[model samples]
Target: DFRPHDEHYVQNFVLVTHGLLMRIFCMCYFRWTVLEFDQVWNPQNCEIWVLEKTKKGRYRLAGSWQEESKSFGPIKFGADKTKLLYPHMKESTPARDMVPGKPGWLDDPALRHLVVAAQFGKGIGVNKELGSLG
Candidate 1:
C-alpha cells in the first residue's frame, strides 16, 4: 500500500505490477466521485471512487483510491484542512484483462508501453511475467 503526497507522486506517476509486487499511483484522468467526511471521530472511515466510463456511457469502479489507509488520513483539503478519505484500492478485472492469463486490467498495451519507456533507470523492473510491460 502506498500513499503519495509529494514530489514522488509528481515524478513517479505510473502504476506497476509484476507478479506479486504491485505499485500504484493515483493520478489518472478518472471521473471521480467524492464522499464527504461526516464526523471528526470517524476520519478513516470515509471513501471515494475513481470511476471509468463504460462503453454504454456509464460510470463504473476503476479503482478505490483510499484517502486514509492506516488510521492516518493520507489526503487533506479545504480551508480548515479537512481530511479527505477514500477506501483502499483493489485490482479490478477490466473488460480488456478478462482474456486468458492476463490477470488485471492495467495490463493494456498503451499503459505498458508508457511504463517500459518511463522506467529505464528508475530501479523498477518491467513485468517479467509477460516478457515486458510493452
Candidate 2:
C-alpha cells in the first residue's frame, strides 16, 4: 500500500514475504517515463512495472551514480524528478564522501561487477521480468 502523493491514488504497491524475505515493488504510472518504458508494452503513459532484483542479486535501482551534497551520501533521483539524498544538506556539512574505497557493503565482486555493468548499460547475462501494463 504505497502511494506517491495520495493514498487513495495508489500509484504503487509493495509486498514483502516474511519467511523468504522476498520483496516486490509495483509502480503504476499515469504515463510511461523513460525509466519504465519497455518495447513490448507500447503504453503511452499509463503503465506498471515491478522492480526486482536480478538473478545476480543486485537490486534494480542499484548503481545509478548521481550528484550529492558534500555532507550526505549519494543523491537519489525521485519519481517526481527531484533529487533526494540529504533532505537538510547545508553549507556547513561535508559535500561528499572523500574516502577512496568503495562502500563496505558493496565489497563483493558480484555486486561491484553489477554496478559497473549497469553504469555502462552493458548486459551482464541478466534478464528482466516483463509483464503486461494493463
Candidate 3:
C-alpha cells in the first residue's frame, strides 16, 4: 500500500522470505504477478496498478539500483526528507512519507534511474526475491 491519498489502494511490492523472516517491502519491484499480487493484497484488482501503467503494475515504483548491491546494517531510512530510502514509506505515513501528487518525471526511465541511484545508499539488497527493476 504505497499510495499517498489512497492508503489501501496500491498493493504489492517486495516480499523477502529469508529463513523464517518474511518481510514485505512496498518499495521493491514485483517478481511476477497473480500469486504474488494476491498474497500481498487479497482480492487485488488487476486493473489498478500503483502510480502509473495500471496494467503494468508500476513494477519498479521505488527505484532500480540493486544490480550490484552489498550488505549493510539494519535497513532504515532515518531522517530522509524526501524519504528516498525509507522502508515501506508510502504505507507508513501518507502526508510525510509521500509526495502529494505524481511528478512529471515519474515515468521517465532515465530520470527514474538517476533518482533511484541517488536515493538508495547501498542499493536494494533483496533483489533476489524482488525483480531487478532495471
Q: Compose the digit string of candidate 1's lDDT tens values, residues 38-100.
A: 111221333433445466644443433654563322343222445332332222233332242
Cα-based TM-score, every candidate: 0.21, 0.17, 0.18
Q: Worst 10-residue stretch by lDDT in candidate 3? A: 42-51
Query: What TM value does model 1 have?
Result: 0.21
Q: What is the lDDT of residue 117 in candidate 1?
A: 31
Model 1 poorest 10 in a row by lDDT: 31-40
Find the 10 residues in a row with the least total lDDT in model 2: 19-28
Which regions of candidate 3 are displaced past 4 Å? 1-20, 25-75, 78-116, 123-134
Task: Name the candidate, 1 or 2, with the larger TM-score value.
Answer: 1
Q: Write the per-residue lDDT of candidate 3 for residues 8-124, one digit (tens) a residue.
A: 665444433331122233423322221122223211222122222444444323332233353222222222323333333223222222121344433433223333432343342
TM-score, predicted candidate 2 vs. hidden true structure: 0.17
Clashing pairs in 3: none
If both were scored by lDDT, which would come out higher, candidate 1 or candidate 3?
Answer: 1
Task: Judge candidate 1 at residue 89 and give its lDDT.
Answer: 21
